[model samples]
Target: MVTRTARHGSDDESGDADYGHLQLTALDGWRGFVAEMHTAPNLLPTAVWTGLAEDKRDYYDDDRIDHHSRLLVVQTPTIRQVIASGRRLVQLNRNAHSGRCGLMVSGPAGTGKTTALTQLGKTVEVIHRRRHPHAADDIPLVYITIAPAATPKMIAMEFARFFDLPISRRANITDIADAVCGVSRDARVTLVAVDELHNLNTRTRTRAGADASDTLKYFSERTPATCTYAGTSLERTGLLSGTRGEQIAGRFEHGPHRSVQPGPTMDRAHRRLGRQSATTPAPAWITARARPLPAQAHPRK
Candidate 1:
């Protein structure tokens, strides 16, 4: 069974602490985990809202999103391909006997890899609910963003957190893996979106020959849920090199177009600004100057 500590909040507040705020602590812990190979107090947030205002902005700007939906955006073609691959996995989920499938989307920053996967997640959730109404309790999509400073232990902890599982530094890796697998198995989460996968690159410094690739391979081979990687194309290629590439490609091949409209087009900008200007209050002088020019100097008749 998974146990999670309740987030501390003022009694005056009506709601629980936002999950995004907790992610900062989780991310900090991930960084410490990489260096120390153990969980530490550094994972706790100094201030809950420190870096999250921007995330809120990004969250709102996501396309095809509604209050109940969670969306992420990606701009790169490779990342888009990975999201497409995730869709294919969900398709295969209809054939449960086929086992698990993994999808890799790699690319550089500002390429919109995360954004693409987010849009894909929304689609998967809707499809899964439609296909398996009986399993409505299950989260159709689980989106996990890898912190840049993440460690294997931190990764495990994040998974535990996501499923509301109890986690301590003393927990065993195999146990953590089992717990994660169990959650996916039970929840029927058709797809797992892992963004910023390159964070696992630190594992390369270890003598065990582990790297982000190894971590990717572990998730690919272990979890029943379809895994999708969202990163730069260059990063994706690097991640796919060697044995792991084969595993990723074998499980999921590329599929059809799943693109969303890119954010904030120039036309949209003009419309928004024009509307704002029209409604905004004007200075008394400006308002008086614009007083219909004395009814068009009587020219209109």
Candidate 2:
């Protein structure tokens, strides 16, 4: 009964390239959360939103209607496993007597690494909403990306910006870090997701990069929330190299990384054998033609 919407934009001016919004809906009790990617306004939907008025929907043309508005959730094994691990980390942070814990997800580009973490944040937000339904103030998860050319001070500033804390432009890095940790604790943030952590290890700012790594470690040690980092292959980015990188690595449990696939097998016998394997069932959907029918009827149909 809880939902949070996250908006993202695309560069295409045509608008069709835009993804509507990411949302999370919590199911009954504390069972689980549903993650949805809605279609951008004016964009075609693969399905219609549930409970839409009969008169307002088009029963026939899927491209003419917004199927993405519906309560559709795609729970791939990757997403489910990531969500489970994140949930466990949150619980660990919640019940632990002291210190903190973390998980890291690494993979190549276009591997849905960010998507997994985004869904996990949505679920965490839903849990926070359930607990503080009336307050509407607590943020269960905090998400931030290390900006290009970021330093330890810049990283601290990003947290300050997220919490909307008004701090002096001249505040030292130490002060900013302290402020971020205090706010995170008081807000009861269960998880902190740092995306594009690869940016921290960029070569231009060698000294600053090392400091940035240490800054993240400090955040993990001082904050109550579990920190999850997502980036291109951690090893390739040198994210876990050097003394500070090693320190950061020691604090985190490396979760699954989407492994690069081996080259295609060219064996004709293997291909022939694969073709003989059993077929999978069609996806469950009620439709007219190949397009799924809207849950609600159209007045004309």
Candidate 3:
């Protein structure tokens, strides 16, 4: 939410009226545009507030949102790190430059780790496609969510599905990996996001998680795309355990410890991440910070 001070006309307008007017004015420039990291574009119409009673309308139209939640992505320190890492990855992938670049985003469940990646993927897709409009088969960004109890085969199948390929479940992991990597290289997919990475650790006292991590490591090593692994405390999972984990960790442009937190302290952190140069050829990383809603403001389920 944006806060603005407005001058109320001495004539019938009270402070509340002036505030509402100010808010509506702010929405004028923002309408129809999705803020960075936000899931949906702002569709609020300013004209609706012209002659309506204050209590007659909601500031945000929930009906405008589809089944998916439209919560905005706040670019706290963690998000900035993710964006910077993605930019660096894209740079490395340009002109077939080989680099085992990756990024791991880990935090508590409600810390917006998935949300950050989702928006980042969307942003990267748009920017990359716009820059290379004539390049067909150039799938700049592909996102794959790790399912519960997902195996390496299952994960490889997910990739095949994402690419709309018809691969049987009985296919060998090596074959699946090769097909996916070949397609990724041909398609020029610059970034690949694997969400809920912690799910690999579901089977404890076994090497299942390690094997899953190995698949990811192999994929990262083979492909030119930047791999992003995100989940709840993903760094603490088996994905980051032992010697192999050390090798994977070294590929990250940013450390796993960085994460977004709520409140004024977070605001201070955002200010310190340094602004991106406008003249730089890289995509402009958005730096909007979302304000926290009051405890009672959430709508009841």
lDDT string for model 1 (1-301, tens) is 1222233233214464444432422433322222221111212142542455775434332311221142222234544445566677667765665447666555446645655676677567666667776874676666677766566666766667766677667878778878887877787766777776666553353322244446555765566567776655433334444565455556654332323333353245445555665788954322432336576578754
Error of 2 at 98 (Å): 4.4
- lDDT per residue as tens, model 2, 99-191: 577888887787677778877887887777777888555667777778776888888887777676889988898888888888788778788
TM-score computed on alpha carbons, candidate 2: 0.65
Off by over 4 Å in 2: 1-73, 97-99, 202-204, 259-301
| lDDT of model 1 at position 5 | 29
Model 2 weakest 10-residue run by lDDT: 23-32
Q: What is the C-alpha lDDT of each candidate?
A: 0.54, 0.66, 0.63
C-alpha lDDT of candidate 2 relative to the true structure = 0.66
Instruction: Summing lDDT over every window of 10 consecutive residues in candidate 3, give the lowest-scoring window.
Output: 22-31
User: Relative to the unseen true structure, what is the C-alpha lDDT of residue 39 in candidate 1, on a scale of 0 to 100?
Assistant: 16
Highest TM-score, which number?
2
What alpha-carbon RMSD in Å does predicted model 1 have with respect to the real structure? 14.5
